[model samples]
Target: MANMQWTLLLLIWMGQCCVIDCQLYEFHYINKEKTWTEAQQYCREKHTDLVTVTNMKDIKRLINISPGNWRGAWIGLYGQTDGTRKWHWSLPGVEFNESEKNWNTGEPNDKTGWQNCGIIWKNLKWGDLSCHDHQYFLCYDDKYILINKNKTWEDALIYCRDHHHDLVTITNMDQQRAVQQEAQFASTDYVWMGLSYACTLDLWFWVSDEVVRYKNWALDGPMDDCDMSGAMETKGNHQWCKKDDTEKFNFICST
Candidate 1:
């Protein structure tokens, strides 16, 4: 009887340890330069795949602890031929949570029409950039880390600026899927993001810090009409905004 009791206690302790271990969030790094396919293979071989975000809180916690890394990195979201951007995880039929989406400019735009990979930027905003762009990324599992308070897509963008520097920009596909999952629930329609246009330069700019690198505008979309407060007549000044908050053809907000 004594031996059996001791064995049962030991089993209970071991089970507790396993639960705790699974809850602990750890960071992984991949330094090899390769195509998106190669990178995904590398991550999978290392007991992980490209990073996947779950919520804004997870993003804040992950970036806060990471140091000495590049600005943009690969994630898991990719483009489809149906003219729709879907989260990779959602490809498995998992519902997206609005709280997980932290788009800097509020919408997913595959400018090149061929971009199938995602990336996270310096300001923690998410975007669908070319998979050829090389950078370090983040990975997440069964860990719970509280992120910034929930706010509307517009409010969220402003919050990122007022507090954390800029709206969340994706550097890789992993981060993209994570954000998509979080914001998916609240996303009834497209929303506004941190991306915008520069009338003088006639190019797209990440509203977070005005950094312009990836220019993937649709055919004659952002036509800068000199309307500072109104919509753009063409693709020149067609800034990205939330789809819900568009008051009379304005921007939309998710969650």
Candidate 2:
């Protein structure tokens, strides 16, 4: 019995150590000017991707990095011309699925032939639009918060990091259910989750770097793709579906 008690204490200590060692994401600013594509390449080769600014904190950090009334620099955001969009979280590691989608009528119609990004309407319906179009976006933090504003997956990631934490990461049924309850009060048809896809890795992971062990995919299964993120239906079994990361939606965050 004494030995078992010691083992339990050791395990608790190890868990605490892990928590202490977990570091929040960092940002690096490159003063050199470059196009979006060039900047992405530079960031990938040097740091991570061209600074995925997730929120006000990141924006401020970026400003502090230079500490000047500078104009602007290229970020990780860019569009694809190959007609194949690669879905990715503003935060890294999260994966996207193609099967889960909630598009509005005639969505992705490419009305102007340049519709390559995604957006969420006030009603929470998704639609494809031009990536060049400018709109307020969302970002994720490492903390938790329930934001009522609409934003794309990448934007949501930045927002959370700036305001509270990253988007909420649900690793268990209890967490999922709690988020589902939060969804009940959402004004939209669904709420954005911290879930996203990494096209390069071809896998899913939470922005918080948690393992993708527990899942709540819908009965129809999830769609796989490079341009989608995970979202929970406000009304159904709370099953997750795929959505274009560019699509805006209210999101939850956690620390």
Candidate 3:
């Protein structure tokens, strides 16, 4: 295993629960215009981070809130410093899929060579513009917050309860992907999740009081034992594994 950073301060990416029937984050339309950076600051201060739209449903919701000749609105998507023209969601752990793009015809031309920021056009497709340009933006309250600080599973639980809601609960695949995005940034090989074993009951259950119906166990079955909780790997496939509760690692929280 990689070495751990026990005392490092970590950033919490306010994430949204992207369940098909439920969402942990709520979106808001800022009618007032601001530069991309300014808008980002506003959102971080008042709400969660800027919105991280993972699928078509998010776009539809954005459109529903910002109707009428929408003009253009800033989104969380941005160009990386590498100039790969690689677009990344503002929230860490959220993914940007090339296949699911909603770009306008002949869009992202970057014709000016410096149109690095992203915006949603009136037609609901995406376009590129200068980051300095002023425009309205969208923000989500809270979803899946990744806490980078390393802590034991028990300590992590207390921290989450004091700061946000509870540790994350992955009851479905969508929630799995949602939490997996944040897991990718963990300083440790794996990040603590909310599931734990109950030796008396002889079963694993989510701390959020949900059943372990949506299983993503790394092995055929998780080890049923005492002093074990669940953690998700940071790399490939991001499957869940039973981890010792006394072990320290970063964690994700559901809000």
Q: For residues 105-224, what per-residue lDDT tens digits would candidate 3 score against the true structure?
A: 998888787787888877778888888888888776757888999999999999999998888988777678778877887899999998999999998998888777778998656988
lDDT of each: 0.45, 0.58, 0.78
Give the C-alpha miss distance for residue 194 in model 3, angstroms: 1.4
Candidate 3 residue 238 Cα shift, in angstroms, is: 1.2
Off by over 4 Å in 2: 1-144
Q: How many backbone clashes does candidate 3 have?
A: 4
* TM-score: the better of candidates 1 and 2: 2
Q: What tens-digit string does per-residue lDDT give for candidate 1 at 1-255? A: 111100000011212234221223344544445566666765566533566655556556565655544466666555555555565641233545566776669546767766667677778888776677665544433221113244444565565555444444322333333344434333233323455545677655555353443333345445553322212111223333312333222122221
Q: How close is every model to the real structure, measured as TM-score?
A: 0.42, 0.45, 0.79
In model 1, state the lDDT of residue 140. Answer: 33
lDDT of 2 by residue, 79-187 (tens): 3555575544332432334444445798757789876555444343456666555432322222234689999999988998898767877766546754775676677
Q: Which stretches of candidate 3 lie over 4 Å from their true place?
A: 1-21, 65-70, 79-88, 92-96, 111-114
lDDT of 2: 0.58
TM-score: model 2 vs. ground truth? 0.45
